[model samples]
Target: MPRIGVLIDNNTLDDHLAREHGLSLVILLDSGDRWLWDTGQSGIFFDNARAMGIDLAQLSGLALSHGHYDHTGGLDRLWRETDFTGPIYGHPAVMTGRYACSCCSPPRAIGLRTVNRQRLASQLIPVSDTARLGPGLTMVTNITRQAGNFEPIQGFYLDPLGRTTDTIPDDTALVLETGYGPVLILGCCHSGLENTCDHIAVNLGINRFHALIGGLHLKSAKPNHIEETLQTITRFGFSEVYAGHCTGTHAISSLSDALPGKIHPMGSGLLLTFPPSGHSTT
Candidate 1:
């Protein structure tokens, strides 16, 4: 069996923990393989981990979803506050600068900050394509847009001046091979969940997934976009999707209403067990 712990998210599973507009997850396999997914927007992940009795330092390795602040903000804290000195995994573009420019507000740097870029560069192990981490775990990247803009991206730039568009090529996911099927975990599927699913199916030869977890990045999605996502999940037979963080309120309501108990909220303090206790929304 395997379990996934929610270290940071936009909401808390209960009143005892805190909430933030970010995301982090800890993956614990029965084989003693522990992996930290993301770091959230601050050192809050550390406090939450301590409260939940999880040791972030005692992990095999770290895999990043992308270069966003919300996903990698705690890197500096992890460097200064913990004994974690393992390898950091992600696409090479994950360290590139990212910004947002829209409406009247000036373009703002939204990529990883507070952490020393040079220090991270020294530790980052680029996973440009799917890399097998263990017997049943794989780091998935190089996501392509086979579907027609399943999630439209805008207002994001690679440079501070907002001249070049940032397609978030570094966005990645983790795949866990299981008896039932493969499980897809994401950091913020910027390439679009539909695209990510399609990539795995076409490239990795995985069709049906046992479960789906992580942020969908649909905070500001339109109704049709949500419907498209619903169809995507149905198309892939993803029975349980623990979505949170950037998944947003409107999208959550729509997804939950459409899928009933199949759609569950993921946040801090939540522990989802699998391989028999697969759908325990605890």
Candidate 2:
């Protein structure tokens, strides 16, 4: 069986745990290979992990879905706190500068911090294509961008002035092979959920995805876009969908309504376990 623990997210399941606008998940494989996905926006992940009784020092490897600050902010603290000496998988462009400017607000840095960048250089394992983390665990990088309507969000830039549009090429997802099917672990899904799934199906030769657990990044999408996304997801025949973080309330509600019992609410402190070759048990 494989167990997934939500260490940090936008919401908390317990009153004692702290909530933040970020996401992080700890994956425990049946083979005893533990992997840490993303780190959230700050040291809050560490605090939440402590409350959840998770030991960071036991991690076998680390992987980042993207370079967004909200996803990589705790890297510095994690480096300082643990003696983990494992490869950190991510795209090469993850260390570049990135910003968000919206509604006349000044551009704010949204990419990984400079300090963490320097710290991670030695351990970082850049994944330009598909890379196997271990048995049944793979990192899918550079998702095919074929969805014409699934454009990148506006006001995001690689430059401070917001002149150059940031396409978020570093966006990636972790695919876990289970007995039921493949489970997708995403960060923000900036590459469009449909597009990401399509890449897994066509390029990676994965026919069906058993579950989708993580951010969808549909916060600012229009109603029609959400509907279209739901329609696309329906084709994947996923048995379970646990969404949080950048997936806004409206999008989650819409998906829940459309998918019925398949959509599960996700937050910090949530624990989900899946049998080696069967359905997941919450």
Q: How many clashes in each structure?
A: 0, 1
Candidate 2 per-residue lDDT over residues 200-237, each given as its tens digit: 88877776788989998888888887976787778888
Ten-residue stretch with the least lDDT total in model 1:
273-282
Q: How close is candidate 2 to the true structure, as a TM-score?
A: 0.95
Which candidate ranks first by lDDT, i.e. highest? 2
* Candidate 1 to native Cα RMSD, angstroms: 3.4
Model 2: residue 213 alpha-carbon error in angstroms: 0.7
Cα error, residue 15 of model 1, in Å, equals 1.7
Give one digit per residue, the lDDT tens place, for model 1 in 1-282. Answer: 878899999999868788888888998877787888988998688888889999877788889999999999988888888757888899999888889998889989998876488888888899988887655778889998765666546789988788999988998988886656678898888888889988888877878887888999888887887988999899999988999988888898899999988898788999877673332111
